[model samples]
Target: MATWQCVKQCGACCHLDPAYRPDLDEYLSPEEMELYLSMVGEGGWCVNFDRTTRECRIYPYRPRFCRVEAEVFEDMYGICPEELNDFAIECCQEQIEGVYGDRSLEMLRFNQAVGYIYKEG
Candidate 1:
């Protein structure tokens, strides 16, 4: 497996998904919070991200979630390739079920079984 540190110039994570966790609400300082909210209102990417520079604008006051280093799971299959594929599959399945009905339960169970093996190993 290859280990990598975010160059910060790459905004891949921000563009990968739109569902950001709200855990950051508590970590922002007053000024940082204001800036975050303002950026969010403008329909920009991550609140701390600089779209032009593709770097974190508020690195000093970044939330814990953002500060977390890319982990083993993240690097697994080389820079989270497998995990990203799994995430995409899960998202598609969820959307399909939402539009239709709960049809992916067996697939979900299979994924859970695989996840348990991965976790235990």
Candidate 2:
């Protein structure tokens, strides 16, 4: 079975483009929405993301929305703990592909880290 794991140096999730996530109001509370919007920087990337290092500047203290924990996923997206692994993998795959391309190094690294073998078409 495939499991979900974050690959180091892959900041694809840092591409916090609100335009890409139109349902922000649906999942996030008003305060969280405000904070989320505040974190967005130029080109929709997260202000806390370090482009030079490709990592989150405030990783240890990142908001609940930025975490991938099963409980957090359940609260945010109604994804059960049993389903978290697969769900997270799919989410990461789509987000990584959206932020970087499907063929991008970030996607490759994420897939590899998760033991996913995506075929190029």
Candidate 3:
């Protein structure tokens, strides 16, 4: 695994996901999703992101998406060939396929079906 460090409370990374994804309810309980929703605000930003003070409201309660490197390592197949293995554990198609088989492929298909990607013309 590669090493990483958070640059204080920049909140820049949080902008990636924007709002508390509704799809989270599928994986997490309704109560947990509610807690996350409580922290979401305008511009789809986490409610914990304070625009005035430029800080986090509940850093302790913040979700794992806020800490992505670790999440990617644990949740995903631990592979991102394009990034030179910076954001996640690097693994070739052969290596990953041996371990994850179709599980990761199913997840990718699900994300694609659920509009996990954004695009514009």
Candidate 4:
């Protein structure tokens, strides 16, 4: 059977400036923002991203954009096919499933409600 994995904690997705996202910060509650802020740092990368290692510190709590499907990644991020791993990256599939396992509906609703859905920038 196949498994899933991400880009080894690559911070590419988190590199975007939250400066343009005051609406983003306001999208969540103060408590949620505080908890999330405790994890973001320089480069607007998630605080979990260790600059030296170029990896996410809090992989487990990473948001949906980080959990993107491989095809969606290439299509949405313009990553070439050769630059990505296969459909399921195997190594951490179980870990991802553990988090998003049976929460498909919840995830969809929450993301939609908060405007976390994708759009071309």
Evaluate all candidate structures by whole-model CA lDDT and list the values in order.
0.46, 0.92, 0.46, 0.49
lDDT against true structure, model 1 = 0.46
lDDT of 4: 0.49
Using lDDT as the measure, name the better of candidate 1 and candidate 2: 2
TM-score per candidate, chains pooled? 0.36, 0.95, 0.42, 0.37
lDDT of 1 by residue, 16-120 (tens): 222443543455556756655555523435666677886777778664334433353353223365455455445434433443344455334434443422234
Off by over 4 Å in 2: 119-121
What's the CA error at residue 96 for candidate 2, in Å? 0.9
The weakest ten consecutive residues by lDDT in model 4 span 87-96
* Better-scoring candidate (TM-score), 1 or 3: 3
The order by descending TM-score is 2, 3, 4, 1
Model 1, which residues run further than 4 Å from truth?
A: 16-44, 70-121
Better of 1 and 3 by lDDT: 3
For model 4, how does the per-residue alpha-carbon lDDT over 24-119 read when each residue is reduced to its tens digit? 453445665665566566655666667788677767867544565556556545556655543324212323333344245433433344344334
Give residue 64's error in model 4 in angstroms: 7.3
Question: Cα RMSD to native, each candidate?
Answer: 11.6, 1.5, 13.1, 15.5
The superposed Cα distance between candidate 1 and the true structure at residue 103, in angstroms, equals 32
lDDT per residue for candidate 3 within 1-121, as digits (tens), equals 3333343433444442323233555545567566666655666666667767757777786666444454444553344444533442212222233433534663344334333442358
Clashing pairs in 4: 4-93, 39-47, 40-47, 48-57
